[model samples]
Target chain A: MHLDKEALDAHESRWRAQLINAVAGFKPVNLIGTIDDQGRTNLAIITSVVHLGANPPLLGMVIRPSPKGVERHTLNNILDTGAFSVNAVTEDMVPQAHQTSARYSGETSEFEATGLTPRWIDGRREPFVAESPLQIGLSLLEHLPLKHNGTHFIIGNIDCIDIPDNAVADDGTVDLGALRLVTACGLDTYHSVGSGTRFAYAKPDQPPRPI
Target chain B: MHLDKEALDAHESRWRAQLINAVAGFKPVNLIGTIDDQGRTNLAIITSVVHLGANPPLLGMVIRPSPKGVERHTLNNILDTGAFSVNAVTEDMVPQAHQTSARYSGETSEFEATGLTPRWIDGRREPFVAESPLQIGLSLLEHLPLKHNGTHFIIGNIDCIDIPDNAVADDGTVDLGALRLVTACGLDTYHSVGSGTRFAYAKPDQPPRPI
Candidate 1:
């Protein structure tokens, strides 16, 4: 099926949005954990996290515009504390991670409500999901505003990482298949990654070789 | 194993970069197609594409700072023409897609060199990979500078999309497993997605219902 801008605009706004979101295909799912000044923990499912660079070790995620002036608790906490955690949402964490999207009262903590435990570092203000196979601690490096669209691209410097010993292969790549990490499509669908296929580094005239 | 900032800095630079890149896990891989003003087609493998907003149907991709004093062909082309195409790389296209990352001269066409066909839309200068399960045409929306890290986040408005009929579900989500699409880990490993698990819309007090 082919969908042009005009055809896409013809559909209901919600339908178009979902359709557009899904067509981009599978996305890495992460549970973004943060804490407000009052010590309230916030957890939200985020699929926009992507690697930005490696030298200084940076990562970026997109924060959508809040609806009708509603408060985005996660974004607000990340901005206020300048610290956040990116936790890989595995198959087991799917239900809890999805529930984090629901709006709860200011005093209510998503960690407590969803039955996910918050693991805190000694001196850091933010928390990480205890159930995650891979967890990362980051400090806010820069946040760029997309003026054309009312979205913010938040970039952070990686300060720490936690992973299972067996998950790290000889080459340093995480064996996500063994961890059974979940990838998201559209809004609620999740998929598990299977065994990886390693290919030889592509050279000018060489065919691909299996590693 | 846990890696703090000091530990990460202690490793060899190349090893550290590879380890940091892979621990984040699977990433969506795309063949970014662009054309120079001289009508030479260029294709490069990019894993940083993330959904920004669906209302305007925007996508953002990170363009790493060029090496030393080199120019990024894909970034330069997109800036010069204000148009580009994003094509999902499938299992069969991995070799060609990966080769696009190699440094080809300005006079070389990665499309022809890699043996991938470039399918151009009517009146559109940018071309999409003919073998991609999903192809999207986009126009430049905005490019934001990341001065802290020396990177550029290129945001674009999706103008059109092409996908296989069976790949899209009735609810508007794409079935990536059916397409046998590939995801990247680190710089060389690729993985195929397994069956998807769907959940109902999350609510404050309701348990997750399977869709």
Candidate 2:
């Protein structure tokens, strides 16, 4: 149906419902804190993920006001450490990545709850997910706050990545199709990106024939 | 790339380059505005467009900081009337949209800029782009202030969408691919999506297999 006024409202409600349901389908990710001494480890499941830029390897996510009351473990930890890892939640690591969202004693580690091993880098205290297809460690760069939503824009500098060799394509582009890129629709439903069809367009300089 | 620290930096930079190059390839979009009572019109080029949420059918973009401080034509117009239209820029309307971005006399009717017509809605008092692949007129639901970026988020409840019959697929999906969707990479580059190469993935309960 055409998206008229009434239809638009229904589409919006449906879309939001799908997003909430689809978060479960998203491959859970480990937001590893990349910090120095005194930095804390905080992990969370990231369903809304996007590629903002490639040159700087910049990616962005909207961090809503967590129930943790301003002292959000992930956001706070990122600010303290100025570094965090966007660990791809694979079919294998979903459980652990999700456990990271649980409410535990501030000192409790999700890594323990999920039984996932943490890989550390020399000279850097931040840990990376051992099972992720790609692990990107980034440094905090800027914040874009959402006043109405009580969300913050947390921009970061990509410092490192841990991508498996087999997932790379022959061409320069990434072969995410082979990796079964998981997509999040809203809250909990998770869906692996299905067969994606592609189409190309010609130049703007060329005019189209009369319809 | 293994995406070590150095590789991460390179990736970010490269993606930035790709984004800028992508937008430069296409025409611009027309960000249409209207002032009622006197029935004045304003239009501008909005290459800095963003898609906020899919579920709620939310749209967001960076509007120029109003010279009169918070008296923004777009934001105020949207807030006052609770409506606005995001008109996609096309080769035919680039000149008008571009000129609308310039310092035009406050009385100038941008709707009159390109000799193009704005299809006015009776109750909403806003207009839609008859030629847009998607012309959505939305009612304001929320407005957020970005303290750090000096930008505001004017989220509207999408009230209507006027899509071409040929652009929609049978399954209720807007087949922009069929219409040759043009996208901006970064600051300037524009590119058409490549041909569809279907890549499939399995469900959660099933063993991971290629579709």
Candidate 3:
């Protein structure tokens, strides 16, 4: 099947969103934890997280423009407090993680509503999902507005990272398969890690060998 | 173990890169195809692709600053031609896709070197990977540079999209499981999709029901 620009533009907005979102395939799923100035807690499930750079220890995620007149609490809290946490969603926590996307008022705490525990670490203002096997605390470093769309790319510097001892390899690679981190597709689908193959570093004259 | 900013800053750079890249877990992998003004074809495997928005059908990816003084052909080609194509990397193409990351002279064609075919589509300036099950041609919409890290966020508007017939669902969701698309973790590890679960749209006061 072919979907040209004209046909994609002519399709219903809802269908286009679903198609485009799903077409990207599996993405890292994380629950973003933020706190407002008044100490209000906000948690939202986001699948757009991407590693930006390691020297500065930066990570970036896109926050879409709020629909109609609704204000996104997650974006607002991140800006207000300048602190947030990214928690890897696990298989057992998939239900609670997805529930964080529900249309709740800003005053309503998604963490409490979804029955996910919020824990404070390093005395940071934001909370981290306690059930998550891996969690990282970040401070807002740069917030750039993406003009092409009304989205904002939130870049943060990793301040503190917590993980299980068995999940980290000697070379510093995190064993995501052993961590049992869950990935997401489309809007509502969740997937668990399966068979994985690691290839040795590629070279011009050398064929890739399985590590 | 807890790795705070102090510890992270003291670690070796190579360890930091591997750990940070792997901590994101699985990410969508694609082969980016482009051609320079001189008509030299270029292809590189990238995992930073993210769906920005659907209304304008925008996609964004991060192009890190060239290591040392070496140039990145993919970024140079996109800027020169104002066009590029993203092709999903299949399971069997993992080795070839991974090899595209090797440091090759800009004069050398990665397609020929990696044993991948470049197919022109819709009279576009760029060529799509012929082996990919899903391919998209895009025109450069916006080019934003990150000041903090010197990375470039290339935003492109979808001009055309091609996918296999059986992979698309009635709701427009792409069944990655059926497509057999492979995802990447860390820098060299590849993983195929596993068991996936779908849930109904979440609601404010209602518990999420599995679909």
Q: Among these predicted structures, which one has the highest lDDT?
A: 3
In the range A1-211, model 2's lDDT, one tens digit per residue, is 2467566455445453432222111122334544334544555665434444444455555566554483366666776767777776554554455455456445655555566667776655577776666667677777677554466667666666666667543323344445544433223323333332222221222222211
- Once fitted onto the true fold, the runs of candidate 3 whose alpha carbons sit more than 4 angstroms away are none
Candidate 2 wrong stretches, greater than 4 Å:
A1-40, A67-71, A205-211, B8-211
Tens-digit per-residue lDDT, A1-211, candidate 3: 8889888988888888888887766799999999888888989989999989988889999998566635478888898889999999988999999998888887799988999999998578899999999999999998988876789999998998988989878888777878788888787889887768988887888886888
Q: How much lDDT does each candidate structure score?
A: 0.84, 0.50, 0.87
TM-score for each candidate, following the candidate numbering:
0.97, 0.55, 0.98
The C-alpha local distance difference test score for the whole of candidate 3 amounts to: 0.87
How do the residues B1-211 of candidate 3 rate in per-residue lDDT, one tens digit apiece? 8899889888899888988887766799999999998899999899999989888888999998576746578888899899999999888999999998877887789999999999987579999999999999999998888888888989999889999978877778777777778878888889887868998888898997888
Instruction: Give the per-residue lDDT digits (tens) of candidate 1, residues A68-160.
Output: 644478778888999999999888888888888776777888898999999988878889999997999999988777787788888899999
Q: Residue B152's C-alpha lDDT in candidate 3?
A: 90
lDDT of 3 at A86: 94
Docking class of 1: medium
Q: Once model 2 is optimally superposed onto the true structure by TM-score, how far is the C-alpha of residue B121 displaced, in angstroms?
A: 6.5
**TM-score of chain A, all candidates:** 0.96, 0.75, 0.96
Q: Which DockQ-derived CAPRI band holds candidate 2?
A: incorrect
